[model samples]
Target: MIAGHGPLRRLKDGTAELHQEAELHVRILDADATLTDYRRYLAAMFGYHAPLEDALAGHEGLRRAGFDPARRRKSPLLVADLRALGEDPGALPPCVAVPPVTTLPRALGVAYVLEGATLGGRYILAKLPPQLAPLRGRATAFLAGYGAQTGACWRAFAAVVERVLVTPEAEAEAVAGARETFARLIDWLAAQTRAAGAALREAS
Candidate 1:
């Protein structure tokens, strides 16, 4: 239903349900969320993104597909935000493992999820409470990564994805990869939420 090139259209349609489920689990729209909640959210994000970015680093297929790993990496930004929030990055729990993205199409699929989140990040940043407003671009670097250029960056990545996923088989692979990424991310965030709740109970 999403109007776009073949691969992107397939990705949007195939992963729509999974994407909605993941967003619900992440609870980005919870207006009553506090600074502590935001910290936990960043931690969850770091855990999800670190491993995936590591796998995509220096990937030959991504480079050949015209995707730039440097411009797209957000794991470091998550770590920085955690540190800025006075949480030690090394003290956070390990990130969940992502499925292997061995081919260009698969990488593009994963990239689609990661890059698409940044679009929504702008809205998330805007919704932060006044007490947490100062952390916008610093402690929330991952969300505000591109600052004003976020839309342009997404458009550029879309162009590359459309170019790389040319064949029918490639488009299918991209959709499969995006669906798998969304599923794993939902599981990981749910686990993190449970862990945080348990910790809160113990402290009280």
Candidate 2:
């Protein structure tokens, strides 16, 4: 347990279970996962991130808290990877069931899940199947987010989270938002009727 009454600690500890569950539900690293599965993963991710980031953009709290959301965007990376794989990202449907980041606390919580993925991107990149070797640089951009700067980026985000979510109410909102992001993302990826439908469902 991260022993602290601080909102960041609470948010991290509170979402630990859901975090693990989300990992289990995410299939990009599965041993048998193939190139098609990778394409679907990006598509599903694009579906989720496209809408979520749109919600976070221009939020005053992010600027006040010293967080730069533009630098943290993953949707573009997903699009580039998809295009490299010979898919038209614009043709894919974006997820509409995205969590609402209506407030600073909620936005922070939602961003927590999205920003955290950069850290795991290294692991995901390393575990990518040999089949992806042909599309190496192009297909792996999303997973190679921030590359060597991932650690610094996470620390900066942590600072913003801890600085902004100082009150109990803010903590509650942030935690709830984080948990919802985790749950909804899993649902968005797992639901068989969305952009990634068949491949993501198979991945799950």
Q: Pick by lDDT: which candidate is best?
A: 2
Q: Which stretches of candidate 1 lie over 4 Å from their true place?
A: 1-5, 129-131
Evaluate all candidate structures by whole-model CA lDDT and list the values in order.
Answer: 0.81, 0.82
Cα lDDT tens digits, model 1, 46-151, are: 8878778878875877876677876688888888888888889887776656767788888888888998888878877887767677777678888787778887
Worst 10 residues of 1 by lDDT: 1-10
Best by TM-score: 1
* Candidate 2 stretches greater than 4 Å from native: 1-5, 133-135, 192-204
Pairs in steric clash, model 1:
none
| lDDT (10s digit) by residue, model 2, range 91-192 | 988889999878988999999889877877777787776666566677888889888888888888888888888888999999999999999988977773
Give the CA lDDT, 0 to 100, for residue 192 in model 1: 91
